[model samples]
Target: MPAADAGGTPDPLRRLTLADLRRRTSMKWRTYEPDVLPLWVAEMDVPLAEPVAEALTEAVRLGDTGYPAGTVYADALRDFARHRWDWDFPASRTALVPDVMLGIVEVLKLVTGPGDAVVVNCPVYPPFYQFVRHLGRRVIEAPLDAAGRLDPAALESAFARATEGGRRAAYLLCSPHNPTGTVHTEDELADVAARAAARGVRVVADEIHAPLVLPGARHVPYLTVPGSETGFALLSASKAWNLAGLKAALAVAGSAAARELAAMPEEVGHGPSHLGVIAHTAALRHATGWLDSLLAGLDRNRRLLGELLTRLLPGVRHRPGEGTFLAWLDCRALGLGDDPAAAFLDRGRVALNSGLPFGTGGAGHVRLNLATSPEILQEAVRRMASAVPDTGRRTREDP
Candidate 1:
C-alpha cells in the first residue's frame, strides 16, 4: 500500500520509483537496455487497486484457474456504466472475449467476409492495421484532422470508397483514440453514426479507453447515440485499471445488432483467462475510488508533461488531448528525419513508439506515455532534450 501525505491522502502512485519499477518482469521494463528509460508502451506505473489484487489473490488461493464461465463480468460492466457514464448497457447484448482487438476481429468477421474493406483512422493504433490485415480484410484509412479530432468529411469520403462496388465494409472506431488521446465529442460521434449508416458501413467502436477519461471530458458510448442502433462497441477495464495482462473484454452490441454479437463463436470466450474475469469484474464493481485516484494522478502527470516539454523540448509540439495518458508529439522542427522515435531511443535512451508505424501523418512524430510519476516524466523530458542536437539553441527562454 502507498503511504499518506500530511493531508492523509495516499499518494502511492507518486511514490513509484524507477528502481522499484525496473524490478518487474513486464515488457515495458525489459524491452530496452537497463540504462534506458522506457516511455514507449501503454502500460502505466501504478499499483493495482486493492479490490483487483484481492480478487486475483483469492482466486489463486482457491486454485480457480479453470476455464472462464458465466456473465458476472458483463453484469459488473453494466452496473459500472450506469453509475459512471449514465448509460444503460444491457448485459444480454454483450459477449466475453480475450481482449478488445480480438473481439473487434471477431465482430468484423461477422459483418464482412474475407477481402472486404475495414476502415480506420490513421496516425491511429498500429494494431488496427495489423489485426485487420491478419483477418484478410483490406484496411482503408480515414486520417484524423490537424487537431487530432475526427473529421466527418474525411470519414464520409472513406466510407464512399470503402462501400463502392457493392462491397461489404466495417468502420473500426477508436473512441478516446490511442496515441493522440483525442476524446470524441458527442456531436462528432453522432455525425459518425449518421455517416456510417448512410454508407451501409457497420461501426465497431474500441472503447477500451472510455474509463480513463480525465476531468473536463465526457465519454459518450457510440451505441447510445441516436443513429447508432446498428453499431457494436468493444470495452474493458484493462486501460483504466492497468489490467491489460488480464485478457478479458466485453463485446457489446446495440439493441438492433444483438444477433451479430450472439453469433460470435463460443471458442472466442475460451480465450479469456478465468482469473482475468474475476479481476476485471472486481475492478468494475468495487474499484471506483482507485480509478478516481488514478485519474487525478494522470491529470497531474498530463499537465506536468506539458510543462516539461515546453521547457526542455520547445521545438517539439504537444497539445494534451482530452483523454488517455498517451501524448502524441510532433518533432518535425527537430529535423530527426522520418522517424523521430528512433533518434530519441538511440540518443536519449528513451524508448517511445515510433509514429511512422501509425501510418500517414505519422512521420516526424512520437508517442510518449504520460502514465508514470512526475519524477520519471521529468527525467524522460530531460534525457530527450539532451538527445536533440543544439538543444540549448532550441529551448524557449523563460519569461
Candidate 2:
C-alpha cells in the first residue's frame, strides 16, 4: 500500500486491488481467461482524475455529447505545452483525431504517398509497423542501440535507404519510446531532426506519453528542435490521463509544416469523440495536480518493480527506463526461449506482451506493464519466477 501523504490522504493509485480491477470490462481485463492476470495493454489501473470525471459528468448531465466543436481542446494543449514542456505550440496549427495511431496514419497520408518508405526505431511500438504498412507504405527499420537508446548512425543509414530512388519518406518517431521506455534527450532529438532534414525525410513524433515523464528525466518534444520546423507530432491527454477509451488526440504541425497539416481532410476530424475532447481538455487545462500524483506513483512503481525483479527473477534483466509505465525485460538469461511471454502466460497465467511483434532486438524480451498497484506488481513477479521450468536455475527454496 502507498503511504499517506503529509495531509494523511491515501494515494488513490496504490489503493487498487486485483479483484477490483478485474471487474472492469476493458480489453486488458477481458482478453485473458478468468484466472489470468492481464498486464499486456497500456491501460492504467488508477481511477479517473477528479477534474476529468467532473467534466464528463457535467457533459452527461447537460446531454452535451455531440460533434466536437470549438478550439477548447487545442487551446488547453497550447497552455499545457507552454507551461509543462516550454513549447509554444500554436493552437491554430492543431487538428483533432480519434487517437494517436489514427492521427499518425492520417498525417502519413498527408505527407507521404502509397509505397513510400517509413522508418522506425525497432524494438519500437508495434503499431508503427502495422499502421504504416496498412497505408500501403513500406516499413524501414532502424534498430535501437544495445542500451535501448536511439542510434543516430543506424537512423542515418535508414534515412539513406528510405530516400533512395528519389522516393519521399517519413520517420515515425516514438518519443519517450514505447516498450523500452527510453526518453529521447533533446540532443538526440535535435540530431534526428537535423539528419531527417538533410535526407529530406519528414519526422512524425508520437508524444502520447509526454506528460507522464517520470522524475529525473525531461521529455523533449521533437517539433521544438531547430531543424524540425516541418515535422509533425501526435499528442493526446489520453495516455497520460488514462483516457484511452475516450478517444481524442491532436496532430500538431510545426511552423513550416502547417501547409501539409492543413491538407489533412476535414473528414478525419469527425472521428474524435466529443466527450473525449471535453475530458481531455479538462485534463490538460485543470488536472496537473492529478497528473503529478500519477507520475509520482508511476515513479515509485518503476523503482519497486526493479527491486522486485532483482529478488524474484534475478535472471530477468531490467532497468526502469526514463518514462512511461512499461518495462522492457530481457528474458534470454531465463532460458525461456525467444518468446518468454508465451512461457509466462502458459505457466503462470500472467499475460504480458510478447516482444516478437516489436521486431528485431525484441526476440528475447517481454514488455511488462508497471501501472498496477504495488501488490499486483509483486504477485506478477512472484508468479513469473515460479513459472520458470526446472531446467532453468531456481531459488534455493524451490520445490
Candidate 3:
C-alpha cells in the first residue's frame, strides 16, 4: 500500500491490484505472461482522472464524436502553461497534430529535407532513432554527459558535423526527457537555442512529459528560452495523463516560427480525433488536481525503487530522475553484459525495457517504470536481484 499523502489520502498508483491489472488488454500487461511482472513501458496503472472520465462520458452521451475543430485544445494548454509555467502564447501560434512524434515528423519536414541530418542526444527514446531513419533522414548522435544531462560540447560537435556541407539539419530534443527523465533546465535550453542558431540547425522540441515533472523540478518549455524564438515545440496531455490511446497533440511555434507552422498543409490538420481533443483538453484544464496527486504518487515510487535497489540488488545504480515515472538503472556492476533486461525476463520472470535500443551509453542499463503499486515494485526488484549471479547482496534491510 502507498503511504498516505499529507492530507491522509493514498495516491493513484496503488489503487489497482495485480489481478485488476491483468484483466486489462493493454500492451503493458498483455506483453508478458501472467507470471511476469511488467516494469517496462510508459503506461501508468492508475485509472482515468475523474474530470477526464466525466468529460468523455458527457461527450459520449451527447453524441459529440466527430472531426476535431476549433482551438479549444490549444486554449486549454495555453491556460495550463500560464498558470503552471508562467508562459503564454496566442491561439494563432498553435496547431493540432496526430501526436507528439508525428507532429515532430511534420515539423522536421518544415525545417529539413530528405537525406538531411537530425541530431539527437543518445541513450534517448528509441523511437527518435527509428522514426528519423524511416523518414529518409540521417540521425547524428550527440550523447548526453556522464550525469545524463545534455552535453554542450557534444552538441557543438554534432551540429558542426551535421551541417558540414551547408545541408539543412534539425535537432530533435526531448524536454523532461524520456527513459532517463532528465528535465532540461532554462539555461541548458537557452544554450541549445544559441548553439543551434549559430550552427544554422533548426530545433524541434518534444515536451510531451512537461506535465509529468515531479517536485523539485521546473520544466522549462524550450520555446520560452531566450534565442528560441525561431524554434518549435510539440506537447500533449497523453503522457502525463496516460491517455496514449487518444491521438491528439498541439504544435506551438515561437514568435518567429509562427509562419512556418501556419504554412503546414491543410490536410495535415485532419489527423487528430475529435474525441481525443476533448479528452486532452479536459485533462489540461480540469484534471490538474488529479495531476498533482499523480505527481506525488510517482515521486514516492521513484524513491522507493532506489531504496529497494540499494537494499536488495546492491550492484545496480539508480539515480532517481527529477521528473516522469521512469528510472534508469545502470546494471553494469552486476555483470549482466550489455542487456540486463533480457536476463531479468528469462531468469527472473520480469519484463523491463532493454537499454541497448537507446543508442550510445545505453548498454548495461534498463529503464523501469515507476507508475505502479508499491507492492508490485518491491516484488520486481526482489526478482531482479535474484537474477544476478553469486554475489551476496551488499545490504540487508527493507523499509
TM-scores across all candidates?
A: 0.96, 0.96, 0.97
The regions of model 3 sitting more than 4 angstroms off are 1-10, 392-399
Clashing pairs in 1: none
lDDT of 1 by residue, 154-233 (tens): 99999999999999999999998998998998899999999999999999999999998888999998888889999999
How do the residues 1-399 of candidate 2 rate in per-residue lDDT, one tens digit apiece? 475444444555787777889899999999989899888999999888889999999999999989999789999998999998999877789998899999999999988999999999999889998999999999999999988899999999999999999899999999999989999998999999999999999999999999979999999989888899999999999988889999899999999999889889999999999999999999999888777877777888899998988777877778788998899999887889999999999999899999999999899899999888888888898889889865454543555
Candidate 2, which segments miss by more than 4 Å at Cα?
Answer: 1-10, 390-399
C-alpha lDDT of all candidate models, in order? 0.89, 0.90, 0.91
Q: What's the residue-level lDDT of 94 in candidate 1?
A: 96
Better model by lDDT, 1 or 2?
A: 2
- In Å, residue 219's CA in model 1 sits off its true spot by 0.6
